[model samples]
Structures are given as C-alpha cells and as structure tokens.
Target: MAKITYIEHNGTEHVVEVANGMTVMEGARDNSIPGIEADCGGACACSTCHVYVHPDWVDRLPGKDSMEEDMLDFAYEPDTQRSRLTCQLKVTDALDGLVVQLPEKQI
Candidate 1:
C-alpha cells in the first residue's frame, strides 16, 4: 500500500493508505476526502477529481496521457505542470507519500 496525502484548498489534510492497483481517486473517495468529487467514479469522464500534484512529485508520478490531458482542460484553473486527473493515477509502492492539492473548486 501507499500512503497518500490529499490537501484541500483550505489546507485541510487527509492522509490515507491506498492499496496498489487502486487509482488515486479511489483512495480519496474511499476515505471520504471532500476535495475530490470524482463525478464519474474511477472513469476519466469528468474533471471533478482534478488535483495539483506536489512539485516534488510531478516527475515521480506517471506521465499524463492524451485523455487525461484533455479532461484537465475542463478542470478548475489547471496548471500545465502540476495538474492531473486523480482517476488516471494508479497507486503503487512508488507512490508512497504522494501529495496532491485540490483546487478551490472543481468545474
């Protein structure tokens, strides 16, 4: 499992243990972390699960695909370098201590 940290716009922090093979969005949803709405469940059909990966982890995580990149265009104030769709991030041991910051609002 990986220990992931989800930070809300107001600075609220939620640290949870996510099993390998689960998506980052699933980790937040299962833990009832409020910042990630995950409107489409684990499917990358919406941008409600958008987050800004901590700069320190931007490269450590997997690269975004065309689909995730397209969905991010609909996210709230997306950052070219840090923005990502949580549903697209599969958890692994390498993601231990991953930190993601939620946007003020999701579009």
Candidate 2:
C-alpha cells in the first residue's frame, strides 16, 4: 500500500493509505477526503478528482495519458506541469508518501 497525502485548498491535509492497484481518486473517495468529488467514480471521464502534484513529487509520478491530459483541461486553474486527474494515477509501492494538493475548486 502507499500512503498518499491529499491537501485541500484551504490548507487541510488528509493522509491515507491506499492499496496497490487502486486509483488515487479511490483513495480520496474511500477515505472521505473532501475536494475530490470524483463525479465519474474513477472512470477518468471527469475532472472532479483533479489535483496538483506536489512539486517535489512531480517527476516521481508516472506520465499522464491523453485521457488524463484532456480531462485536466476542464479542471479549475490547472497547472500545466502539476495538474493531474487522480483517477488516472494508480497506487503502487513507488508512490508511497506521494503528496497532491487539491485545486481551489473543481470545474
């Protein structure tokens, strides 16, 4: 399992353990972390689960696919380098201690 930190725009932080193979969005939804609405339920069809990967972990995570990139366009104030759709990120041992900050709002 990986321990991921989800930080809200208002500075709240939720750190939870996510099982391997589960999407990051699932981790937030299951743990009841606010800010990640996940309207599509980890289907990669919506931007409600968007977050900005902490700069320190930016290069550490996997690259985004076309679907994730497209979905991010609908996120609120997406940052080209850091914005990502949580549903597209799968948990793994390598992602342990990963940190992501929620946008001010999800569009």
Candidate 3:
C-alpha cells in the first residue's frame, strides 16, 4: 500500500493508505476525500479529478500523456506545470508518500 495525501483548496488534508495499482483518484474516493470528483471515473475523459502534485514529487511522477494534457485544458483552475488528473496517477510502492492538492473547484 502507498500512503497518499490529498489537500483541499481550503487546506483540509486527507491522508490515505491506497493499494498499489489503484489510481490516486480511486484512493481519494475510496477513503471519502471530498475534493476529488472523478466524474469520468478513471477513463481520462474528464478533468474533474485535477490535482496539483506537490512540487517535491512532481519530478518523480510519470510525465503526463497527450490525452491527459488535452483533458486538463478543461480543468477548473489549470496550472500547466503542476496540474494532473488524479486518475492518470497510479499508486505504487515508489509513490508511498505522494501529496496532491485539490483545486478550489472541479466543475
């Protein structure tokens, strides 16, 4: 399992232990973290799961794919460098302490 932290725009924090192989979006949803909407599930077809990966960990994550980049154009408050769709981030042993901050809004 990996321990992931989800910080809301309001500074609320949710730390969860997520199974490896699950998406970050799934971890938040399963743990009842309020900020991740994940409207399209993990399909990468929507931007409701947008998050800002902590700067310290950004370089550790896999680069975003073209499809995720295109979808992020629809995110509520986009940040070209830090923005990511949580659904695109898979939990793994190597990402045990990943931290992601939620936007002020999803829709």
Model 2 poorest ten-residue lDDT run: 66-75
Candidate with the greatest TM-score versus the true structure:
1
TM-score pick, better of 1 and 2 = 1
Between 1 and 3, whose TM-score is larger? 1
RMSD of 1: 0.6
TM-score list, all predictions: 0.98, 0.97, 0.97
Tell me how candidate 3 scores on lDDT. 0.93
Please give the distance, in angstroms, between residue 57's alpha carbon in candidate 2 and its true position after superposition. Answer: 1.0
Steric clash count of candidate 2: 0
lDDT of 1 by residue, 4-104 (tens): 99999999999999999999999999999998999899689999999999999998988999999999999999999999999999999999999999999
Candidate 2 global CA lDDT score: 0.93
| Global lDDT scores for all candidate models | 0.95, 0.93, 0.93
Backbone clashes, each candidate: 0, 0, 0
The residue-by-residue lDDT of candidate 3 on 5-90, one tens digit each, is: 99999998888999999999999999999978898888999999999999999899999999999999999979888999999998
Clashing pairs in 3: none
